[model samples]
Target: MNVTICVGSSCHLKGSPKVIKRLEYLIAQHHLEDQIELSGSFCMDQCSLGSSGVCVQVDHVVHSVTPSTVDSFFQEYILGGLAS
Candidate 1:
């Protein structure tokens, strides 16, 4: 899985750092370090529409992600797929 978190000025202000930290922890917890490719980008062009001012791309799908939503996002997109 490829996960890209926007680190633009807007996203940074909205707490992208926290989101990144939590995701790192979650990926480690699940032992997906080899399967998941995590990265950061300057802008995704979705920041203006994001309620949290942070945009994340999981594979090719863009989502408005915040630190609080990272857990559910991981569950649904990461772990959920593994279960299936």
Candidate 2:
């Protein structure tokens, strides 16, 4: 899966760095380094939409993600796919 996190100014202020860190740690913990490709996007337009969290794209599907929600996102989108 290709996961892209918005690092635009708005997202940065909203805690993108922390979200990225937690996501990295979780990906490593799940040994998904090979299965997942993580990257940063300059702007994804979610900021203009007034999203509460950082804008993240999983396989081109965008989502509002935060550090606190990283675990569930990973579990459902990443790990859950592995189980199936």
Candidate 3:
């Protein structure tokens, strides 16, 4: 799976770093290092939507995310059939 998290100014201010850290830890904890490709990007065009400015794209679907939401996001999208 390809996971890209926005690192634009808006996202950065919203805690993209924290979100990235949490995701890294989770991916390692679940031994998904090989199955997941995580990276950072700039401006996903969702920053103006409010809520957490962090926008995560898993494959092609995008979702507004935050550090606190990483675990649930992983369980539902990364580890579950939703991703497949």
Candidate 4:
């Protein structure tokens, strides 16, 4: 899985650094370091759409991700996606 996080100005203020940290920890905790590839990107343009959290792209599909949503987001998107 390729996880792309938005590090643009909007997302940086929204806590992109924490988001990146949490994801990295989760990937390591779950022993998915080999399967998951994490990366960064510029603006995803979701902020203009009024999305609540930072934008994260798993593969190519985009999703809003906040610090609060990190765990669940990891469970459903990363772990769950790997399940199937």
- Against the reference, the lDDT scores of all candidates come to 0.85, 0.84, 0.84, 0.90
Model 3: lDDT of residue 53: 51
> Could you tell me every candidate's TM-score relative to the true structure?
0.90, 0.89, 0.89, 0.94
The count of backbone overlaps in candidate 4 is 0
Identify the candidate with maximal TM-score: 4
Candidate 3 positional error at 22, Å: 0.5
lDDT top scorer: 4
Write the number of the candidate with greater TM-score, choosing between 1 and 4: 4
Candidate 4, residue 78: lDDT: 90
Rank by lDDT (best first): 4, 1, 3, 2
- Tell me the deviation in Å of residue 56 in model 4: 0.4
Off by over 4 Å in 3: 81-83
Error of 2 at 20 (Å): 0.7
Clashes of each: 0, 0, 0, 0
Residue lDDT tens for model 4, 1-84: 899999999988888999999999999998999999999999988886426788999987888889999899999999988998
| Cand. 2 Cα-lDDT | 0.84
- Find the 10 residues in a row with the least total lDDT in model 4: 44-53
Worst 10 residues of 2 by lDDT: 43-52
Off by over 4 Å in 1: 82-84
lDDT of 3 by residue, 1-84 (tens): 899999989989988999899999989998889988999998988876636558888899888887778788878888884356
Which is the better candidate, 1 or 2, if ranked by TM-score?
1
